[model samples]
Target: MGKYIQQTDMDAYRFYLASMEKSLATIEKYLRDINGFCSFAGGRTITKELVIAYKEKLIARYAVASVNSMLAAINGFLSFAGYGCCRVRQVRTQRRAYCHANTQLTKSEYLRLVDAAAKTGDERLNLILQSICATGMRVSELAFLTVDALWAGRAEVCLKGKTRTVLIPGKLQKRLKQYIKRHKIESGPIFVTANGKAVNRSNIWKAMKRLCAAANVEPGKVYPHNLRRLFARTFYHIKKDIAKLADVLGHSRIETTRIYIMETGEEHVRIVSKLGLVA
Candidate 1:
């Protein structure tokens, strides 16, 4: 005996999220999650029982993290819509001490990816991969790598209502300058299509996937975010400072940065075995 959430209420919820300064990506994800729940409920009123049932359905189809993320969106919507009592519990996930081998892109593999891009004469692809790794910037933040930022030796990345300065290494600055001169890019984002629009995440992802075979790297390890993670690991290896790494990566939480530098299972075992407990 409950009432279905109205379209007007959904629109208002979207406006509320925007007012809270949620990033475009986050807002879209929240809306998508809420829409998914609405579809599942099929115009019925959302209740605790209904939400619990939906959680069970999601458990069968998605991973724990994804399910929790979806639940977060639903909970946010419920709070906004005066249905807090109906909010469902998120699935608890075990902490991961190590990442799977297939997803962990090694430094050697990263070099191979760059070499492969160069061999193919796809200069943009090559530089894009290098830029993310060198700067340790997220793929989405590449839009900030404009000619002006290059000249200044730092990119001003604004996302999720926060702005941060991402420095460009001196060597990378020289290369980027040369690339700009070679391409005759007067101003604006260096990475863009012929139409002058900044390349989107999906395009960048597909471009990296295309390089895997030529690079002789596993396809699973060739995504753009992995390049950022590679940067995190490399920086941590050299500096061994987690706080500094978090600041560089623009992460509010050091724990989030730790995830980026999490070792693979093989590396974890090697370190654990060195404890000398097996005398």
Candidate 2:
């Protein structure tokens, strides 16, 4: 009924997101989702029913979590465009206590991934894996791993308009120093391409994928974010402190941290076995 999402409306929504200090990734995704909905609507009058129809189309093609993310982007854009009532309800699903087996990266597998990189004489990749796993930092924070941070034995990572401190382990600091010396890196991000720019996520992702075969780890479990989860699980195993771990992982919500340290299904089965309820 009201005018379809106009170019001026989209431009205003982008400015609104920037005013709220939304992360670049979030802003891009929201705008992309809004554009996709616009394409689907094809100048038709926008309504709640049309939104519901688009949601159904999404459900047929994507997982519930993915659909919810797209819906969230749509809702954010709608509210920004002064059509808040056009927002659709998110799909309801039970919370998962454990991640899928295919997604979980065991400590042994992680070590093998490191070894695989080293075996191929890829020093940078090896250190990248160790840096992320040891510090529980997001891949985007990799840019903060600079020569100065190495000397300081900690990195001040600023992400999503919030800054957090990530401590470098003594052994890891030593290794990084060696890497800096070997590469003759004077003062900049430790990980850089031949052109000396900070290594981007896509390059790191593809490099990690190449190690999957030699590491004997599943391809799905080899991304940079999984390394952070590995660190969270290991820290919780040793200290059993969820609250402190949440701080170290830069999460404002402990519930979000809980997702990182969920036990494996095998471990859950072992715990259930201890109950001895079955004959």
Error of 2 at 49 (Å): 1.8
Cα-based lDDT for every prediction = 0.91, 0.91
Q: Least accurate stretch of 10 residues (summed lDDT) in model 2?
A: 1-10
Q: Model 1: which residue pairs collide?
A: none
**Candidate 1 lDDT over residue span 106-198, tens digit each:** 989999999999999999989998999999999889999999999999999997789999999999989888998999998999999989999
Best by TM-score: 2
Superposition error at 219 for model 1 (Å): 2.1
How far is 158's C-alpha from truth in model 1 (Å)?
Answer: 2.0
**Model 2 over residues 1-279: C-alpha lDDT tens digits?**
256878888888899888888868778889998898999999887788899999999999999999999999998888877778888999999988666677799999999999999999999999999999999989989999999999999999986679999999999999999999998999989999999999988899999999999998889889999999999999999999999999999999999999999987877888999999999
Among all windows of 10 consecutive residues in model 1, the one with the lowest summed lDDT is 1-10
Q: What TM-score do all the candidates reach, one by one?
A: 0.93, 0.93
